[model samples]
Target: MTLVKSLYAGIATASFVLAALPAAAEDDVKIVASFSILGDMVEEVVGDLATVTTIVGPDADAHVYQPSVADARAVAQADIIFVNGLGFETWSDTLISESGTEATVHVATAGITPVKVDGMTDPHAWNSLSNGVIYVTNVAAAMKEAMPEHAGEITANADAYIAELEALDAETKSKLADLPANRRTVVTAHDAFGYLADAYGLTFLAPVGIATEAEPSAKDLAVLIDQLKAEGAAALFVENITSPALVQQISEETGIVIGGRLFSDALSERGGPATSYLTMFQHNLGTLLDALAHETAS
Candidate 1:
């Protein structure tokens, strides 16, 4: 597997693939989103005008995701493929080529300047409400380009959706504003919150960096435990998509309470707390506020 270290590299590669697609049919719009989050965004814009399929399902990790034969078949039959560029879906190119998809592929992160984690650009743009708006706009633009007849409708829907995202951004700030500045520090399993931290005026500390696939050393854990104690980290939380064992151990050894389970890489399944993109943000904000509120009250 090629280790993609930068978002710009991923963008360059995606542009190359997108440049290769021939013009597609109008009514035969079939979209294959690389993961469920992008799938949700695409569905919001395209609605009934397109048939959508997601290669990675709800609560699944895209970092080390391998393409199944069925997923390859889905790509093979798609009319257009939408992906979150910036090395989010590393298996995408191989799957698309192997599946023999001649479809046009679009990057939903097209317009936004992606925030990088480590030396590479972090691909989890949907975590920030501001970035989420840009994602929706990119999806709408792609839909419009593919099916010009619905261009006006897609644009209108995107505008309405963006309005809601603007509200979400404001509401998130409002929800987080009550916590004291020192109490805003959060420790999670991975560096998934660069965007969230930048947006909400909170601080994120992870012993582990961009990938949860890696395990922190005993020394690293000890250092982190000390940092949590010295920094007076208000809460520690486990991510929905990562193992809770490390976080539980951190909580136990450090005596810092487990604040909450955060929905990080993937959204929850239908009927769950974070089924939709909006609901996911709401759930995360509520969980964080509850923990911090408890600390403040005491």
Candidate 2:
């Protein structure tokens, strides 16, 4: 009886220790982002307080991304999920439903006034630094709500990041001001830059609609080419997320020089030019200015 009692006590102690082990190991909050850009923002806000898993990574097209089993698993395990939520991730709703996670879903673009084109809300609001401030605010609030113990840290990080975004906004405006007004028209593979155009006072034209999944009609392409020729738009840009073939074909047809690759829907991979949000904006500005400057000089 004495030996049996001792064995039972040891089993209970082992069970208690095993249960407490998870409590000790689960220190960081698990966050899942719908894409790379939002992943970067969440990482910046959470710092070391959370582990962020991005579903659609850098240089990948989220518009057509099909979430895999691993992605669904990540969502299932996440404590919080951040999504852009302007119909940006078409697959996200189904994935979230399938994941069956009770995690809080936060739309990063909650408070911003979205620009609508053809009755569709533009999901690329992050293109404008001013709107980026709103994104950070929403992300910070979500993080605070999820992990109240780290609220102070999250707020400080968000404030610092927003300040950087403000500086980037000012710099973008100043750089764009140097371009000739006539050369301010930008043509890209898709209509991903409406927010950027609206914010920075440039005119953006695209053959295809906002979502890459939407195929551009022959009529649309013809109209865009005619408009480009009529407007004498000098620069055409290829987006990092899209195939350059369509833009290349457009350039060949119109004799408009391909300006450069723009980081439209996604950031560049790590160790690339447009790695971070700040660097992405800087690189894009430089590319536009370089091309526009050349056009103005010619």
Candidate 3:
């Protein structure tokens, strides 16, 4: 289990990163997260009360994730497991089954209503800070279930985490309140920001929808380019998990400059700008405001 945790932390052959910040775990309960985002959430709510292990690490795409042997082993040893579960991790089911883990698998987005795209669940609920509160609530409940003795401590931690989320929610709305309707339209690499757009009054157009499993077809790219040309956009941004090549191509064809990187499905590395879920959203909000709001102000 130790080796498996190390593997997820990228002490071996993987580009993935550690779960969260500098905190020593009590190691009381073994927790497995399907990806870095959930890992960070688990850390925030449970603090050091639980030993959290992540399967998909920093800047890695969970939609197309391939679970490792180490991940399976970790899941097998876990006392609790957290997954986003809107068909987000296609590989999670197989991995959990093969591992024969008896750990209670918790879905962070279980209670929230999901955004649908073409009759498919968007699976990116964490994009909105409001929905993130739901995630933290679910995490806190699961932690209490796993370690009943630490219920008081877990509740306190979850309250702090939720407070932060609520603060950010207010900040987002305040910051974006002045943004005009015409300037609210933005372009991203994929359709992962629907919840965010809905929550904050923005419109996101993308070449790829929901997941990045398939490369955007030429027609899809053409359509996106044409839409941007016809209606215009505030800014075009690329996701951390996706390649900038497609975005670059769209920019060249449509004459819209690429804005900056957005942490869509994953968090950045430990020393990077967005190591935790809160920081990831903060970073993305800043990026958007810098390009859309700041530029408009200037």
Candidate 4:
């Protein structure tokens, strides 16, 4: 009888322990970001608290990305989805609808006052370090709400990241201030740098509008050429996500040197100069400054 009782007690204890094991093991919150830059921000904010899946990857154009069935499946499984709202992702609505995800959707650019161009909102708000802070904050808030158990960790991570963004913003302003006022005008393939221009006191002119999918009309090209000549812009740049054909043509016609590639819409691949948000900003600034400084010397 004593041996039988001990065997029963051991079985009960084993069952209890098995039941408690799952409760002790925490599940990671699943998060999906619309593109690479936002994915980096989400990763920074969540640390290891969540698993981040990015749809549009490095050196890819989010403006023209089409979601696949696998992407929908990932979205459906996400606990939260972060998008860059201001009409940046044209297919985002369809993806969300098709996935029928119950996930909470957060637009990273929620509180930003967007720079408008040609009756359309420029969705590249992340180009500005200040707006990058806002993106991080919104993501952190969403993470806290989705994973309340990890709210403290999310908040701390976000605070530290925002501080770094603030420092980067200060550094950008200082660097831009070093350039001559007349030399601050920049010409690129697309008008994706409106927010950066507004934030850094530079004038950006492009032949094509915000969306790279649309080609520039001949009239638009003519007008941009005239403006470039009038503004005496000496350096032209091509974006990472755009074909350099147009800007290269412009550079040849106008005798403006082709400055190195700028990571405008998307970041470079891993181990590249503009891999992260911070590195992207630094790389762009350095590239621009170096090109313009060479022009100044000449």
TM-score for all predictions?
0.88, 0.90, 0.89, 0.89
lDDT by residue for model 3 over 165-206, one digit each (tens)?
999999999999999887888888888999998899999988
Candidate number with greatest TM-score? 2
List residue ranges in candidate 2 displaced over 4 A: 1-26, 296-298
Better of 1 and 4 by lDDT: 4
Mind sharing the TM-score for model 3?
A: 0.89
| Total colliding residue pairs, candidate 3 | 0
Candidate 4 lDDT, 1-298, residue by residue in tens: 5743543444445445544654323475688999999999999999987789999999999998866656766776677899999999998887776565778899999999989998999999999999999999899888887788888999999999999999989988988887877778878988899999999988888888899989988988988877776667857888899889999888867777787889988878988898889889999999988887666412
Q: For candidate 2, give the lDDT of residue 287.
A: 91
Q: What is every candidate's alpha-carbon RMSD to the true fold?
A: 6.1, 9.6, 6.2, 11.8
Query: What are the lDDT scores of the predictions, listed in order?
Result: 0.82, 0.85, 0.85, 0.84
- Model 3 off-target regions past 4 Å? 1-27, 294-298
Answer with 2 or 4, whichever has the higher lDDT.
2
Candidate 1 residue pairs in clash (backbone atoms < 3 Å): none
What is the lDDT ranking, best to worst?
2, 3, 4, 1
Clashing pairs in 3: none
Per-residue CA lDDT of model 2 for 42-118, tens digit only, reads 88999999899999999999999977656766776678999998889998887787566778899999988989978
Model 1 weakest 10-residue run by lDDT = 1-10
Candidate 4 yields a Cα-based lDDT of 0.84
The number of the candidate with the highest lDDT is: 2
lDDT of 2 at 4: 38
